[model samples]
Target chain A: MISQFIFIIILGAAVYLFGKNVAKVRRNILLGKDTDRSDNPAERWKLMAKVALGQSKMVKRPTAAVLHLFVYVGFVIINLEVLEIMIDGIFGSHRVFAGPLGGLYGLLIGSFEVLAFLVLASCVIFLVRRNVVKLKRFTGTEMTAWPKSDANYILITEILLMAAFLTMNAADYKLQALHVGHYVTAGSFPVSALIAPLLPAGAGALEAIERGCWWFHIIGILAFLNYLPYSKHFHILLAFPNVYYSNLNAKGKFSNMASVTNEVKAMLDPSFVPETTEVSRFGVKDVTDLTWKNLMEAYTCTECGRCTSVCPANITGKLLSPRKIMMDTRDRLVELGNNIDKHGKDHTDDKSLLDNYITREELWACTTCNACVEACPVNINPLEIITEMRRYVVMEESQAPASLNNMFGNMENNGAPWKYSQADRFNWAEKG
Target chain B: MELNIPTMAQMVAEGKTPEILFWVGCAGSFDERAQKITRDICKILQHVGISYAVLGTEESCTGDPAKRAGNEFLFQMQAMANIELLNAYEVKKIVTGCPHCFNTIANEYPGLGGTYEVIHHTQLIQGLINDGKLKAEGGESFKGRRITFHDPCYLGRGNGVYEAPRAALEVLDTELVEMKRCKTNGLCCGAGGAQMFKEPEKGNKDINDERMVDVIEAKADVIASGCPFCMTMLSDGVKHLNKEQDIKVLDIAEITVRANGL
Candidate 1:
């Protein structure tokens, strides 16, 4: 009874802490400016189902997709068993659902053991890929220190958790064979049954191992849950909502700034007075200038360098890595969120995302090719952020490059990007 | 070799509206090399007897460059002016040589109260071929040569029109080779997002040079392109490698024109 009480307290505290972190993430995302992503509910649901739930986009790279699928499907399925653990801990019942579920419980546990084994093997392979083989996509300039270790750390934690789960099942199965008190002949552990012979024969020893493994497994999962908010593994949660709200329009369309449109309307049609909102500096200067969807995408980034690997600028050795753009956004958001927490919302950092984190050269080098958008397993649009920052640089500061300034001037004065007269537009036809 | 390209103004004056308004983008109108592609598209349209008219002098830049360069003021001004003129014409179907113009007018313009069935020149040619209007058999045989098509970022990945341009190329007798990074995985020609206007920011290799490697690796005599900006970038890449005499960078329309005996 005392152990059960202690378990309840630990579980409650973990759940509370996990909830707090998630709430903090929600607050940080809301700190971004609002843009309506609520339109097209039907399409959004379909996309979410396909991309996030179905893992449709993931299969473009078959090898990683298969490995990730094993881990993903396994982790999700095993959490059902976690749900049962929560119930057992709260109610102080041994395999509480066993009597009602009957043979179905056995079937479920057998399958879970198989999934746990797969999860363990997959994580070991993943650790090898990241540390030993070192895939080029994972070893980019942005995958420094914490980012690199964050991936490995989660994989290791998962391996440890799965090991404990299998070991616990094995010990419990042996105890059931010994006919120990409260150790019912329940769950059919096909994989763990192999290890039953390797365990201690004595009921007392088996019970000690079973209890130790159960506590370790549950605690490890709770700790992993809390750690997700601080790691790239947060994508496991954010990818669903991130993909649902991703841009559904044609990839070519960069949205026209409505404020700019209103200004243009007044100049073009004097009779039309457009409604205007109080403006901040044009485009994205900091994390707050970004749309909430953009902020969510920042958090949703898996730090998979699929985008950077395919980037024209990055491929040719330019500084712009799309993955880095996402990382920087998240890093800045975390910093700003912490600042607001400590010093209130009115705090000033005097440092912005624009010159401080992402450089002008990095911004200028992007081709806006949408390679990054397509490459993301989850639909994260790094191009939008790049264009928005470019907007602030051009409109707010008039800091466009000399050539782009020339191109803009020519377009305004001559109706072409060059100094050619509009009269010359028909010159191509005059040839015949 | 006379072509039957009329301005919307002239066609309207004669009480005969064209089936499609051909938006002769700034590149097609003024870029010296791109002008040849403009002529070839006109020849194909004439050969196929599709009633298409140019926007002519009234047409302005689509402000893709301006918008991409982050000058939203200039971009909106251009977009609004263009949308007004396009609306005035009551254009139902439109086609353009450049993907940038097609994307902007088709996708972006509708939000500003200007929407039409905007199709790229490659898609236009692909349609004509599929409809049995343009027979690309033996006018200028490319049977002995291998041709690789460079996917313009805006056209292929941007608008998801990868297959149309390839369809036009497939009709030709030439070997249609694909680069490793083709279709949705296609690399940029280093000129998108208004990058064409400015010097590239301190990269080890120019994007065009990297794209040219794909063309070279595909072992093609010709690199077929649709976007004028791509034509310029890829052609400059050929010049960079001094491979101009060996490899020709022809627009898909130009290729279609050659194949149809126009």
Candidate 2:
């Protein structure tokens, strides 16, 4: 009765904290401007299935894909055992499914043990890949202390959770073998059986170790659930919705702002009266100017750096790194969200996502080749943000680079991007 | 090599409607390097007995560069002017040798109320080849020559047209070599998104030089492309590598004209 009371209190606290943080994040994302992407539910569902569920794009890099698949699949499948553990914790029961599930429970436990081992191995490899091998993409300028440490912490946490799971099962198996206390003997422990012998024999020692491991595992999972909202691991939840609401238009087609289009149309008309001569900002100057989809994209970044790895500008040693763009947007959103929390809803900041985080050199270096957009496994479009910011720099500030200014002038005057006039458009035909 | 290409106004005056409007893009109209491609396309149209008319002085830029460079106001002004001319002329079907123009007219223009059946010149040539209107047997046949295609980003990935240019080239008796990165995975030749209008930022290397390494690694005798901007960039790359004498870069229209002996 005491153990069950302690379990209920801990579980309640964990659920409350996790729910509060998740709700906070949802509210933060809603701070962005509205963009209605409700069209075409069929295509959105298909994209979610292919990208999130099938993991089709992840397989582009086969080695990382397979390793990640082990952890991902292990995390998913082992969580079933977590569900059982939670129930057992609440009721102060050991192997509650053992009698009812019988052979199926044994099969499930055996598979969980194998998967736990695989998850441990994959986590170790992932750690080595990030720290020891120091892959160029992982160690680039963007992988600063927080992101690097965050990755290491997640891996270490996963390793510990899997280790605690196996240790708990090993002690439980030994206790069942000795027919000690209230421990039952029904489920199998294939991998942990190897561990069972290493543990000291006796009922009291086994029960204490088993309960300690059990508490550690459950507490670790709850802590991980809460940590996700604040870490890049947030992608584990956001990737599904991100891919589902991905931009389905052809990659070449950029979305036009309807307001700007209407303004341009008014200018083009022969007889048009301006209703409001009041100035309208041409493009995004702040987070509120960006669409909700853009903000959601900011939150969904995995920081895998596949985008920066394949970025032509980054590879060619330019200032542009698509991964950095997403990271900056996320950081700015966090800053704004925190500001709102501290100073109430009407809070405003002098620092915007533009000059405070991303710079002109970075934005200008992008060729808009869509390489980064294509390379992103989760459909995070840094290009969209880049283009929007570029529009702000150009239209709002009128601060394009000198060469681009020349091109813009040519287009304005000659109706082309070159110095030549429209009257000369057919000059080559005369030569023919 | 003189080709008599009629203007749309001339055709209209004669009370005749050409099957298609030949949208000679700015590069094809003004750039010396792209002029040869323009003539080749005109020669092919004549060879196949397809009546085509140019807008002549009435033609203007499609504002692709302006839109890309974040000058939407200027782009719209240019686009609206051209749309007015196109709508007045009643140009139903249009074909252009430039991918920038093709992409803008086919995709972007529809949003601004300027919609037409915009097709790339390679697609038009492939259709003519399929219709058996143009013969591939004659002068300067590419028989057994190693030819690799450099996909223009706007044409290939931008518009999802990886096959039409290749299909047009398949008629030649040459070995069609492919770069390591082709089709959807093809790299940019350093000249998209208004980069053509300005100098490249300080970098370890130019994007064209990097793409040139792939082209040279393929070891093809000739490099074929469909977009004029790509032609300019790839030609500059070939010159930079000093392979100008060893390798040749020709537009696909030029290839068709040479193969059909037009």
Q: Which stretches of candidate 2 lie over 4 Å from their true place?
A: A273-280
Model 1, span B190-246: residue lDDT tens: 999999998999979999999988888899889999999999999999999999999
Q: Candidate 1, which segments miss by more than 4 Å at Cα?
A: none
Q: How do the residues A1-432 of candidate 2 rate in per-residue lDDT, one tens digit apiece?
A: 998999999999989999998888888788877778889999999999999877888887899999999998999899999999999999988888888897899999999999999999999999999999999989777789999999999999999999999999999999999998788887799999999999999889999999999999999999999899999999989999999989887777777666666677777774765555433566667776777888898889989998898777788888889999899988888888899889999989799888888888888888777878878888889988887888888887899889999988877777667899888888887674
**Model 1 lDDT tens row, A1-432:** 898899999999999999999999999999999898899999999999999999998898998898899999998999999989989988888888799999999999999999999999999999998899999999877889999989989999999999999999999998888889999999999899988889888888888999999999999999999999999999999999998898988899999888888888899889988896777878999999999999999999989889999999999999999999999999999999999899998998998899888999999999999999999989999999999999999999999999999999899999999989888778887774
Candidate lDDT values, in order: 0.91, 0.87
**lDDT for residue A283 in candidate 2, whole number 0-100:** 66
Individual DockQ of the candidates?
A: 0.85, 0.67
Task: Look at candidate 2 and tell me the lDDT of residue B87.
Answer: 88
DockQ of candidate 2 is: 0.67
Give Cα distance to truth, residue B203, candidate 2, Å: 1.7
